[model samples]
Target: MRTQVVIVGAGPSGLLLGQLLHKAGVDAVILERQSPDYVLGRIRAGVLEQVTLDVLAQAGVDQRMNKEGLVHTGFDLLFKGERHRIDLSGLTGGQKVMVYGQTEVTRDLMDARQAAGLTTIYEADDVQIHDFDSDHPSVSYSKNGKTQTISCDFIAGCDGFHGVCRASVPRKSIQEFEKVYPFGWLGVLSDTPPVHEELIYANSPRGFALCSQRSLTRSRYYLQVPLTDKVEQWSDDAFWGELRNRLDPEARENLVTGTSIEKSIAPLRSFVTEPMRFGTLFLAGDAAHIVPPTGAKGLNLAATDVKYLSDALIEACVEKSHAGIDHYSTRCLARIWRAERFSWWFTSLMHRFPDQGEIGQKFQEAELDYLIHSEAGSRTVAENYVGLPLNFGE
Candidate 1:
């Protein structure tokens, strides 16, 4: 098999990159290690930044999103029973986030790709990328116990943090920066309706709890806990009790309790690899960096990466110059770091650390109190939440 580009992963980044390249008349092939059903059913990110939504719309993939996604102008910060709303539109000048699950976005993009007659190999195994520096880079994979190789002009490593694509690059050329938080998020999805109209970040003596809605019929929530804690130890009763203690007490009565539809724990971390590109293989999304979930920037950052990557590849193929690809690393890093900093700031503010002493805890509470009470602090939250525009030229 042969193509202009080979995308390794069917997640948001790879799928969107394929769609964008297809629109520009570039031939591309996508390979995924997971089954199509599993890829579409995985529950992940729910918030879409304004810039992400705009990109989807421009790409003609927002038909279902605009109809199914829930829009919000603001979110609430709950501290000491006091609720403070950060008006995103007011601070960001007409920007708001849309609540749409990452699964739905993947479904939409995959459907679009299929309808356009694009080739996407799911359940592909043993996928290996080779000769990224050569004029003919190739991706070899096995499907149904049959091995095959697809050659391409460029290889896009969007296979995520654990995938082999990133590690394929020699270690001497890579510089990694990482910070693992002491706390992890216990995320759950339930059939119960949301207790509030907007998402709420609650600060309590117990810990941090985020109240968010996936849809009118489903609610998504998270609790900050020790990274070492196991989900099995948190029974349904214990989970609800913890949620009640962390969220607004008065709203507890209104918080509907339901059987958990899905539950999982994710460790919190911030990571970035300097220079996101190496020769003809360009890394995007989780393959390049990771952000703590506090600011909901992971998916948005991935989308931003594909946006710039698609443009660069199109220019390289059309103009016959490696100029765009040559600068891919430096250009994507600027926006990547901005988002990295924002996620770090939000995570630091919201999650309590076990190592934090009494003085540190007191200072954290004071900061939360001020953020909830001061307009300036609220605006800062709003701006970061809505997302800062990507600096593609960098």
Candidate 2:
């Protein structure tokens, strides 16, 4: 098989890229190592910035999102037993975020791909990228014990952190930066009304907690836990009790508890790889970077990566222009580092550091006091939360 582009993942980033390219009259094929059910089963947070929403619309897959996604203009920061609201739209000149599920976004993209009859090979095994360093690049994978080869002009590595695309790069050519936090987030999903209309981020003596939602009827909450903790160690009741301790009095009163449908523990980390491009291959999404969920930048960053990538690829394929592709890495890195800084800063501000001790708590409280009380600080949070505009070498 031969194609204009070979996308080595069926995740949202890859799927969205394929959709955008198809709309732009470019032909691409996608390959996935997992079944459709497996891909859809992965639960992920979806806090859509203005940029992400626009990208989804650009891919022509925002019909369902627009209908079902909840729009939030503000959120609360609970610290020292007080709840302080930050008006996101007010601070960002009417920019807001959408509370949608990542799963839903994937489904929409998948459906669009199928409706358009795009080629996507799922459960492809031993997928290998070949000759990416030269102009004649190709991808190979085993399906039903038969080896199939696809020669493509370019390859997109949206497979994820553990994916084969990034792994294929020689270590010497890539430089990595990573910081693993000492704690993890224990998250729960339930079919209960949210404690409040908008999300609430809390910092308490016990730990940090987040009261987030997927919709008015479905809520997702998280509590900070030690790195050594296991998901089985905390019962639903215990989780609820601990969460109650972290929330403000009003949230405690309004909190509704129910059986959790899903529960897991995820460690926090910041990871980024320099120069997202390797010859004819380009890495997007988790394949290139990871942000701690503190600021909810993971999926948004991935979306932006693909948005830039799709545009560059389209320029290369349709307009016969290498200018966009030439500046892809520099422009992406510029925006990515800013988001990395914000995620790191927000995580540091909200989480409890075992090494920081009592002094750390006092410092956190002082900073939180100033952040909530000061308009400038609040606007800063709002701007980053709504997402900085895309800078494509304008």
Candidate 3:
């Protein structure tokens, strides 16, 4: 097979990139190690920054999202038994987030890609990239007991953190920075209506909890837990019981409990690699960076990364301009670091670190008190939550 670009991983990042490139008259092939059903089965974050929505629109895959996704202009910050609304729209001049599940977004992209007749090989085994350091790069994978190779002008590594693309790089050629939190989030998904009209980030004596949603009737909630905890340790009744204990009285009273459709524990971490470009190979999304879900920047960051990457590839392929591709790393890293900082800051503010002790708790309370009461502090949180502009500092 031959193409202008070979995208590794059929996840949102790769799918979105392929869609964008195809719309721009560039030919690309996508390879995924898992089936489409397996990809959609992975429950992930649902918050959509405006930038992500725009990119989905650019990819021509926002019909379902615009129709079914819930739009929220604000969310509550519960602290010291008080619920304070951070007016995201009011603070950010009408910018808002869409509560659309990541799975839905991937589905839309997949549907669009299928309708457009793009090439995507799923369940591709032992995918490998060859000669990415030179001008001509190619990808190879095994399928149906036969190996096939795709010769391409460039390779896109959107496979993810544990993916082969990143693993293929020599350790000395790349620098990795990571911080693993001591606690994890125990999340539950149910068909119950949300307790509040908007999402709530609550900090209590017990721990931190988040009341989020996928739609008006489908709610997703989370609670801070020790890393040693397991899903089997908590039942539906216990989960609801513990969640109620963390919320303010009003929220607790309004909360609706039901059997969880899905439950899991996910650890928080901030990870980033420098210079996303490696010779003829470009890395985007989780392959290059990962942020804690606190700031809701994971998918949004990936969208922006794809936007930058697709534009760069289009410029190089169609316009015969190498500028965008050349500067892709510097441009993306700037925004990536900013998001990493925000995610780290937000996680630190909301989570109760086991090592922080009483002093840390006092400091968090003090900051939360100031943040909600002060307009400037409130806007800071609101703007970051809504996502910064793509050309943030530039």
By TM-score, how accurate is candidate 3? Answer: 0.99
Clashes of each: 0, 0, 0
| lDDT per residue (tens digit) for residues 290-345 in model 1 | 99998799999899889889989999987877787887888788888888998998
Q: How much lDDT does each candidate structure score?
A: 0.88, 0.94, 0.94
Candidate 1 overall Cα lDDT vs. reference?
A: 0.88
Pairs of residues clashing in candidate 2 = none
Ranking by lDDT: 2, 3, 1
> What digit string (tens of lDDT, one per residue) describes model 3 on residues 1-394?
8999999999999999999999999999999999999999989999999999999999999999999999999999998889999999999999999999999999998999999988999999999999898998899999999999999999999999999998888888899999999999999999999999899999887899999999989999999999999999999999999999999999999999999999999988999998788899999999999899996899999999999999999999999999999999999999999999999999999988888898898999999999988999999999999999998999
Model 1, C-alpha of 288: deviation from truth (Å): 0.7
Candidate with more favorable, higher TM-score: 1 or 2: 2
Candidate 2 weakest lDDT stretch, 10 residues: 385-394
lDDT score of residue 42 within candidate 3? 85
Lowest summed lDDT window (length 10), candidate 1: 385-394
Better of 1 and 3 by lDDT: 3
How does model 3 fare in lDDT?
A: 0.94
- TM-score of every prediction relative to native: 0.97, 0.99, 0.99
Off by over 4 Å in 3: none
Candidate 2, lDDT over the whole model: 0.94
